[model samples]
Target chain A: MASIDIEAEIRAEPPARAPVQRVTLLAALSWFAAAAILLLWQDLTFQPLVRELALIWGAVGVALVALGLAGSRLGRVGRWTALRAPWLLAIGIGMAVWTVLTAKTGLLPQPFFPTPQALLEVFIYDWPKILHSASFSVWLLAKGFFFGALAGFAIGVGMGWSRAVSYWATPLLRYIGPLPATAWLPLAFFIFPTSGSASVFLIAFSTAFPVAVLTWSGIASVNRDYYEIARTLGASPLFLITRVAIPAALPHVFVGLFMGLSTSFAVLVVAEMLGVEAGLGWYLQWAQGWAAYANMYAALFVMAAMCSGLITLLFRIRDRVLVWQKGVVRW
Target chain B: MVASALKTVPQAAGTEINIQTVSHHFDLEGAPLPVLDDITFDIEPGSFVALLGPSGCGKSTLLRLIAGLDHPAQGQIQVAGEKVADPDPSRILVFQDPTLFPWRNVRANVALGLEAQGTLKSEGHRVDEAIRLVGLTGFDKAYPHQLSGGMAQRVALARALVNRPNVLLLDEPLGKLDSLTRMTMQTELVRLWQQSGLTAVLVTHDVEEALYLAQRVIVFGPRPARIVADLQVDLPYPRHRGDPRLAELRHQALGHLGLDSSW
Candidate 1:
């Protein structure tokens, strides 16, 4: 009744490759259009809507230039647009320089926060502070994730592997897993200082509990029939866990680990905001107290970039490791 | 339609095994639920026997008893002058479902029993030969999921045969296949039986199939099951469906089962 020709579907292939001319052409047209808009709009008034649009387009031009350069380096374009990187970079620099010149000539009103020169000055002057804060925060996050996820995964596997352990620990862990890390802030303050160690502990406490619970449930749900076959084949309990159970639970474990990573980052930021002296959260609070809104905005941008980049990195690792699930849609 | 028990013909002697007064019961809580009540039968070596019975009639329980998967609450079962205690490689049981490991391919599944017993290297030649014997010549790397029910059952047969078990216990191995596949599998099974000459005890409810495959069909009754009739099919190998002798024997077996009342 279940007649399926899997081979036929699998063996079919699409047609041969097309030229890169179309994509390169589109990129070139977009770059030129962005350049023209910037040159035309540099002298406009600084209305909130128009100013935001200009700033956003200005960033887009810069990004396009970088993308074009990188694509050319990777030999991604046609023969005509092979040298498009220099053209794009020239357009970007020309627009930015023209915008600065127009502002100097009093053609455009002053920016709300800073002139282009002032924004550069802030970036140059505060580079060291921003770098230090980001590095310190990232370090704490990594430390929390490494220790917490490892310990949680171990505990989960152990508890799930044994019925007695599950019976004893499940109740306690269930009660603790849902309690937010912020709820423990007061307790942590009394227990440890607002230093690096407390931040890490807060991050770990928030991340590890949920990760353990997920992992235990994941391992518990592994197919019992696989284990029976293993047992019938004379596999020891340890062998069964290592060979059959773990591989089957790996995708879920990775999901838990990723969730743990994000939670740790979030908890680190909040914990730093409490009283920590050196982190992105601390930097934001420090900037706001002094009414330096630009510095706060910049720190916020850096945090967003870091979180996005780290998530992409995690997904890349997952893709490479779990390549077997690529074509199959199990989840 | 109950024919009196026939004056038993003397069987050619070769390993005259005995299953003495075997009775099995399920002890659920404190109550005794009898499955097979005082089952006494003898299967001579190198003979094809069918334990024919309706569903829930303890045919499989009897087969399991012979396969050493379960113990009788009372009495003794002896094979080749030795008492049965536990499942051994010498006696293999093929279930109604193909219990092949999904992770392993056909050849690996077949070779598992040998590998588990740590005889793979020493018995590699025989494993290959058994795979060839079951007509699964090229399907070495085909996993169980990729196999059809009939093919998977064949792989199970190969697995059982590769171990060179003296007694083969089949618990409705072809029950899951379609009519065409079942017929082909039955033909293939008979061919293999003739070629290998292993003593096989197949449990089935289909009276016609029981007659077609087995040299002797042991009929059983339900509710504390026991043997009710033992019919012999004297027709030779490769028996036809419309063989008049088979038709008469089929009707006799059906009548004994009281299916004539339904018609």
Candidate 2:
């Protein structure tokens, strides 16, 4: 019988796996191809204007490659690049190629499809107006979101916890919840003193419905065992609701908040178009009337970035509060 | 630290438990299904009693009744001459699953009872002591998911122990653990019971576990559970697992449950 050498086995090193290189190579190739197209391809004879954007794109591609090479020493940033290099590269190249095809080559329609250069020009020239409109929209969104979330949360807990509340609220929710906020525009305008207040109401009404429904469902689905355990620990009904039920239902509450946020943004845009003097929605309509499609596109881009940024902020809050669900949930 | 911390908290003197003609039923699809039928028993203070029975024998239901999680449908249960009305921190039930709040870390989970009672500020030291007692000293910051099965159950034990309950009602607490962990935990349970001087009523289907831990074993029949046999093991503390007396008692308990002793 042969005796196994445990010491030697413990001292031995396992084989090292190779790093992912093919995707990195492909990502680099795509970036280079995009840069080459931007540099060599001439269609509309607009040289100086497109050159600046192309230079920026080319610099980004170079930086990405440099980051990938120095990834071993870069720690988290390097690892993140290694993981997301393919998608990042694809997006960069796809946007560049699409801009070249539509804006320079005129393969797509003009005015409707504004060049990236025109969009940039709009940002440079009309930045002050855009910023003013953005701030106004943000203020409206904040007021509406805060009040809607607060009221919805309270109503949801009540509806879920008490039979009497549910009995009355369920039917009301059923009747009012499914109706779109825009549908209530005519009534809201008459009901509220100002267009701004009417807009706020529309946004709030849209946001509250989803939040209330989700909160009700979330609270209803909390494990009975937790309640029993809390009760055994001498917890009051208030303690049970606040500490036990609320915390347990947080994951569901977050889902509700996310839905509410999206709907609120949609309502905000439409409500702003309802004779509101200042907001991204009002700006978009003004830009469209003047046939400045570049400004419209720029506004759309800003709205997209802002909405996504808000959602990201909410996700960060959820991750911090619901620490127990760390590895279980991911975007 | 353990000794001083233990001394600081008032020791929960075991309270006598009395059940008078207790019966319970569950409403399954609007039809009443009988669970426990006319069960009566008395548990002395500071004694360890094992409720040994077959699966679904309503032993857990009986334990829940004693814990005041539910009221007996027919009869009444009293603890130290006072009628059991609602669940109190004085009587803590440790379920089969560890049931530690996944949101709270080990230390916070242990502190839950005190926090609920609004005495957390004064009795906060007990949480650390309980964690130490359960041998989870280094895992104070660990979440329930981060801990192993045995560790989670240990945290659950610590959570209940922190409250210093006079009556610890265990409903198959070690039923989910691996054999090795279960055996080690059984020893730990006996040690905690001996040290604390609290009345313990354990519900388990494991014959060897009942034989190893309890001074007295109460056996119950299936379905509408009723006490079939009650036997006392006069063996001393730190009883050996391989002792002939334990094997004899195991045989007796198994025979009462209508199972063959020759496994």
Identify the candidate with maximal TM-score: 2
Angstrom error at residue B47, model 1:
4.1
User: On residues B1-263, what C-alpha lDDT tens digit does candidate 2 reach at each position?
Assistant: 12233333355878899989999999999999999999999999988899999999899999899889899999999998899999999899999998888888999999999999999999899999999888999899988889999999999999898999999999999999999999999999987887677899999999999989988999999979999999998888788999999998888888888886464
Using Cα atoms, each model's DockQ against the true complex is 0.15, 0.63
TM-score of 2: 0.89
Q: After superposition on all CA atoms, how large is the RMSD of candidate 1?
A: 9.4
**Compared with the true structure, what per-residue lDDT tens digits does model 1 show for residues A215-251?**
8877888876455444444455676677667766777
Looking at model 2, residue A179 earns an lDDT score of 98
Docking class of 2: medium
Quote model 1's TM-score for chain B. Answer: 0.92
Query: Could you estimate the TM-score for every candidate?
Result: 0.68, 0.89
Which candidate has the top score in lDDT?
Answer: 2
Off by over 4 Å in 2: A1-103, A328-331, B1-10, B260-263
